[model samples]
Target: MSKKEKFEELLKRLQEISEQLESEDLGLDKAVKLYEEGIKLSKLCHQKLEAAELKINELKSDVTAK
Candidate 1:
């Protein structure tokens, strides 16, 4: 799959994690596990976005230089 597809999948999982975290009756251990997973997903998403942004900026600069 492409980076965009992977990023979209990660974003969807992050939203799922958020919903799970917000549940009223979740067990402490399960919540903690989900929270850790969510943190990993969040970091991955941030990295993906930062990489995409840098690539876009580089493309813009290249176009300007041409």
Candidate 2:
């Protein structure tokens, strides 16, 4: 999948996990597992955003240099 699609999918999964985590019926073990997955996804999303930001900055710099 493309970067944007992967990011969106990760974000969607994070949202689903957030909703699941909010439920009162979730068991502790499962909640912990979901929380762990959420953390990983969150880091990935952060990395994607950072990479995009860097790319945008580089593009702007190139335009300014010309």
Candidate 3:
């Protein structure tokens, strides 16, 4: 799969985990595991966002240079 596909899958899993955690029936251990996964997902998502921001900044710089 492509990087975009992996990112999208991670995002979907994050959303599912978020919803599951919202439920009161989740066990403590399971919640901890989900929280770890969520932290990983959040970091990956932040990295992607930062990359996109950098790309946008590059494009803006090019536009200004022209």
* Candidate 1 segments exceeding 4 Å error: 1-5, 53-66
Please identify which of the two predictions, 1 or 2, would achieve the higher TM-score against the true structure: 2
Each prediction's whole-model lDDT (CA): 0.83, 0.84, 0.82
Q: How do the residues 1-66 of candidate 1 rate in per-residue lDDT, one tens digit apiece? A: 335457778889999999999999999999999999999989888877666643333333556666
Which numbered prediction scores highest in lDDT against the true structure? Answer: 2
User: By descending lDDT, how would the candidates be arranged?
Assistant: 2, 1, 3
Tens digit per residue, CA lDDT, model 3, 1-66: 326548788889999999998899999999999999999899988877776632333333556656
Off by over 4 Å in 2: 1-5, 53-66
TM-score of each: 0.70, 0.71, 0.66
Model 1 TM-score is 0.70
Pick the winner on lDDT between candidates 1 and 2: 2
Give the local distance difference test score of model 1. Answer: 0.83
How big is the positional error of residue 37 in model 3, measured in Å on the Cα after superposition? 0.4
Which of the two candidates, 1 or 3, achieves a greater TM-score against the reference? Answer: 1
